[model samples]
Target chain A: MKNRLKVLRAERDWTQAELAAALKVSRQTINAIEKGKFDPSLPLAFKAARLFELSIEDIFQDEVTP
Target chain B: MKERTTEAGDFTACNVKNNVRLLSWVFAWVVTLVLADKAELYEWHSSAFISIAAIVINAAIGLGVIVVFMRHLKGLDELQRKIQLDALALSMGVGLVGSFTYSLLVTAKFVIDAEVTDIILLMTLTYVVGVIVGQVRYR
Candidate 1:
């Protein structure tokens, strides 16, 4: 999965830690998500969407597996 | 970005503190054991009392360390909690299997006396493995 978390966070002038605090997650988690090192769970994705005032589809996209 | 850096720094500091506490406890215990052994404390008439006192002291120290560590962990976010839980579960599973295998080996006379140090080492290894598993899985 790919997400516009970095862009959204940047637009909001929010650091990963701030976003993580709002979402009740660790800064490392936010960093990993932004770096595409880890994929967030469905609930986490929804939380991020809600925080950004955007739909989940707008924030994240699924990669098709061949 | 600043906040992220601070949080990351805090996490690193906390990890370092935890390692220090663990190392200190191990060192204290080893030193006490060695001193007692050399002094022939076990052969003393009040050896039982001294042994009991030592056990109590160790327990208190261990409890204090665990409590401090847990208090720090309590403030963790959802992702942190999930990672911790996953790690703990892995540790428990691995520790159980390792202990059971050791017990089986003992029963079959395949191994000699298994000391407390052996069990402690096993548990430590379990935690190390758990951390490794969590890092790999979450990454």
Candidate 2:
């Protein structure tokens, strides 16, 4: 999944650590998500969307391949 | 998926630490065996005492290593935690099947005897399999 987590976090001026704390996850998880190294579970994705006050679709999109 | 950002250096360090601990355990056992042989300790009831002491010490050290590893794992991210859990589950499953198979073999008289070394080897194999499976699944 592709997500605009980095952009959202930047807009809010929140560091990965801050977002991670808000979500009750380790900072590494947020970093991995932002870098697209990992896709969060559904519940975690929803929690991230909720925390950012955005719809899940607004935050995440399916990856497109050629 | 993007590239997996594994801390290879940290992983290597952990592996090295475990190897060293294993070597130390082997050395301790060898030393105990030599002492028992030299002192003729195997001739008397003291043989059991030495054997039990060695076993207890090894078990304590093994448990200590496990505790330390678990504490380190507690610092890992969610992905790592999932990997660890999957690995542990695999280990347990493999261990159970292996143990059952050994028991069946013994019961059928396919094997004359089952020894402590056989059980240890089975456990080691289970752990190796678990680690391999975990790495593959996560990758």
Candidate 3:
């Protein structure tokens, strides 16, 4: 999955640690998600969407073509 | 104040508490295990009676370690929990394999003085390596 997490966090001027704190996850987790090494779970994706005030599709895009 | 994160990656506040409790339980289990071994070896008190008592206490503490570990897993964030679960699965597989090989060695008239502790140590080492690998892989 591809996500705009890094771009969004940068737009908000939030460090990875700050963003992690907001999401109640480790900075490593946020880093992993941004790097596409790990995909966020549904609840975590929802949390991120809520934090960013956007829909999940707005933040995350499926890399697979339908 | 700089936030403290003692976990392999970075610890959350609840994770710190979970880590402490898990460590405390593990330490207790180790201490009780040593005490039980010593009691059995030295024939302390009423020999069999003291040995049984120590073994019982040690077993109960071992159970505590298991409970604490389960809670620790539950408290971890998703990625951390996944890493831990993967490491545990690997460790368990290796432990079972080691046990079966040891049994074979014993039945084959091999005079090796290998103990169950050896297998346990191997499993622990494997789990540590597995966690480290997972962390690095995700990094």
Candidate topping TM-score:
3
Better of 1 and 2 by DockQ: 1
Off by over 4 Å in 1: A10-26, A35-66, B1-47, B136-139
The clash count of every prediction, one per candidate, is 0, 0, 0
TM-score of each: 0.65, 0.53, 0.89
Alpha-carbon RMSD of each model: 4.6, 7.8, 3.5
Misplaced by over 4 Å in model 2 are A1-38, A41-57, A61-66, B1-53
Question: What is candidate 1's CA lDDT for residue A57?
Answer: 97
Residue B90, model 3: Cα distance from true site in angstroms = 0.7
Error of 3 at B119 (Å): 1.4
Residue A17: error of model 2 in Å? Answer: 14
Q: Model 1 Cα displacement at B4 (Å)?
A: 7.7
Worst 10 residues of 3 chain A by lDDT: A16-25
lDDT of 1 by residue, A3-53 (tens): 899998898888766777677666678888888877888898999888789
How do all the candidates rank in terms of TM-score, highest first? 3, 1, 2
Q: What is the DockQ of candidate 1?
A: 0.31
- lDDT by residue for model 2 (B9-28), tens: 34435556756765666566
Stretches of model 3 off by over 4 angstroms after superposition: B1-11
Best-to-worst ranking by lDDT: 3, 1, 2
Question: For residues A19-47, what per-residue lDDT tens digits would candidate 3 score against the true structure?
Answer: 88778788889999999999999999999
Using DockQ, give the best candidate's number.
3
Candidate 3 residue lDDT tens string, B1-139: 1232233335576788899999999999999998888776776666677777888999999998998999899887899888999999999999999889888988896847878888889999999999999999887
